[model samples]
Target: MNTEKTSSQPAYEPGGCLTAVARGIALVVVVPVRLVWDALGYCLKHLWRWVLAPLARALGWLIEHLLLIPLRWLWEWLVVPVARALWWLVEHLLLIPLRWLWEWVLRPVARALWWVADLLVVTPIGWLWRHVFAPVGRVVGAALAWAWGIAGRISRAVGRALALVLWHAVGRPLAWAYRVVLTPVGHWLRTYVGRPVAEAARAVRAATREVWRALFGGPR
Candidate 1:
């Protein structure tokens, strides 16, 4: 039997073993380092937003405070007074013709209103008060006096009788009741009658004054 030469596979190289081990170790360290570096980059990318947020806010505040604030301050402290003075000068100087025109335009209406007011409020008030209230007041006084006189006479008669019969204690109360009861009623009647009488007197006085002013003269 011819036996073929059998060759054992070459022994594994030691350097190859070392190189593989080194490559494994390098892979192990490199993977973790790369992972850590990627995580750091992600964290920094996100952290950039948080860092710039406060700086942006601060810059906006600086623009407002440094620029807008001074401008508004100057406007308030200087511009308002200057504007008002210029406006007043223009209104009083340039607007005179307009004022004259406005007044002339309104003059006839104003005169009509003044005449009506004089006739309604002033002339009537003065004339009616001068003539009417006096006479009406006298009439009311006379009526009050009449009622009071009658009441006094009645009370005196009753008092005399009651005193003679030793009932004088009741006389005082009766007299008081007579006065209290009749005074308000009589006054109320006087007020009711006096108001219309006074108004009528005012109308008459006003008419008379007008007629007299027309016929004779306004005043003596």
Candidate 2:
């Protein structure tokens, strides 16, 4: 009994040594990996949040508020006023003299020449027209009027005779036929055909409006 050992107890354990060795190796590998991961995370968070993000926001605000806004204000206030003044000086100084010369010198000379030509040529033509041509024109006009009056009277008499014959021969029968047959037919067609056509057209228009509104979502 003193020499026998319990079966649950091991005298020399080989697996226990192996487990201790495995735990030591895992701590050696995982400790460095975890330290590198934590260091990388800390660097990234502080770099962006403290340095890069603030610098970018400051640059954007400086450009928009200070540089771009002042440049626009300077252009509107200084450059625009100088440009308008230059244009005004050019128009008043250069164009005004040219306009005065054209109006005062050139226009008057052109008008004087026109008056001389009218006096020399047009006055004589007018005298001749009034004194010589007018009398002949009046006599010819009177003769033509007399001939036209005679022709017109003959034409009037012929037209009246033809009109009377037409009325007796054709017009009375046509009028009678229209009163007897065509008038009632026209009235019946207007009452039946026209009313139904108008109603159908109204219904078609209403349906078209409804379809148009359905498609386009608006009043027709």
Candidate 3:
């Protein structure tokens, strides 16, 4: 038999009540925070966009037009002219007499002293160097050259002897040892040890690839 069912209200949930209370509390808490945040944001935006920005622009304009412009003008008009005048006075008034004195008096005296020195000291020294020292220097230089040539010949002979001795004693033995011992050893190692290692490495790589493929179902 079919029973007639009455409509029943859903059961009240504590979670929904708690969620609504939490939402209300959150709204109460967040409203003031959002309001304060918005107020501060508005204040900062306006402060920067209107007040501080304009103030900064005005300060920049004032500095450029008032301070820097005036300083530049003063420098160009007053300081530059004064500096030019000072330079002109120093060049013409102060330096001209000194230059004239130096040209007329000091320069002439210096020239006369130079001529005397040439006549007395330099000319004699030059003559001695040309006539006396040059011949002695030539002799010494020739002797040195002869000695150097002899030394070079002796050195060449000694070097040749050393090279011959080394060839017989050291170089030939080293070459023979390398050819007989080291080359054979290196060849044996490359053939026996290196080949086996390479083969083993290849086998290991193939095995690893097979295992990886088995596990991952692909090469990657």
Candidate 4:
């Protein structure tokens, strides 16, 4: 009787091809965006509160007290005397323009609204006389389409003018409110959320620094 010898199985390489492929995919998908965000977060932690925030506050204060205040007084000082002198000179000039503008602006808007009302309400009623309410409704749709085109143009012009007025009237005041009145809210956010985050970041940075110091043999 002949006995056959059995061969031993070869050992598998741990984390061979599939592991490399998964690692490559992770590097490609995850690293760059994560690095960028982390860098920004790090900078915000180390830089923003410690550096730029004070500058922002200082600049805002400088703009408010140094620039805006002096300009306001100068404007009041110059405007009063000039207005008195040119009051009669430009009285007729301004009166005509003010009257014309006030008269014409509302007139155009009223005319547009009236035209729309006649087209929609009046013309639809006229169509109802000839046909049913369905046909009248169809005519109203077409009239509304025409009115929309005209209204769109007029509204764009009005919106631009109104935007400038709103910007000048409300923008600075809103900014001031946000800077001054909202300070407590900002401080609360910083105290509750931001301070903890910064503290965590400081811990992380310290740990990273220690790790780097160990590996590279230098202080971070």
lDDT for each candidate structure: 0.87, 0.94, 0.96, 0.88
Clashes of each: 0, 0, 0, 0
lDDT of 1 by residue, 1-220 (tens): 2333334446568899999999999999999999999999998877777877778888999999999999899899889889999999988887976788668867877898999999999998888877998788889999999999999999999998877766557766677877998788889878998888999999999999999999988766
lDDT of 4 at 218: 95
Least well predicted 10-residue stretch by lDDT in candidate 1: 1-10
Global Cα lDDT for candidate 1: 0.87
Backbone clash pairs for candidate 1 read none
Best by lDDT: 3
Best by TM-score: 3
Sorted on TM-score, best first, the list reads 3, 2, 1, 4
- Checking candidate 3 for backbone clashes, the offending pairs are none
Evaluate residue 25 in candidate 4 and report its C-alpha lDDT on the 0 to 100 scale: 99
Q: Which ten residues in a row have the lowest lDDT in candidate 3?
A: 1-10
Candidate 4 clashes between residue pairs 3 or more apart in a chain or in different chains: none
lDDT of 2 by residue, 1-220 (tens): 5456565566888999999999999999999999999999999999999999999999999998999999999999999999999989988998887799889998999999999989998998899899989988999999999999999999999999999999989999999999999999999999999999999999999999998889888943
Error at 76, model 4, angstroms: 1.9
List model 3 lDDT by residue over 46-145, tens digit each.
9999999999999999999999999999999999999999999999988998999999999999999999999999999999999999999999999999
What TM-scores do the predictions have? 0.30, 0.32, 0.39, 0.28
lDDT of 2 at 152: 100
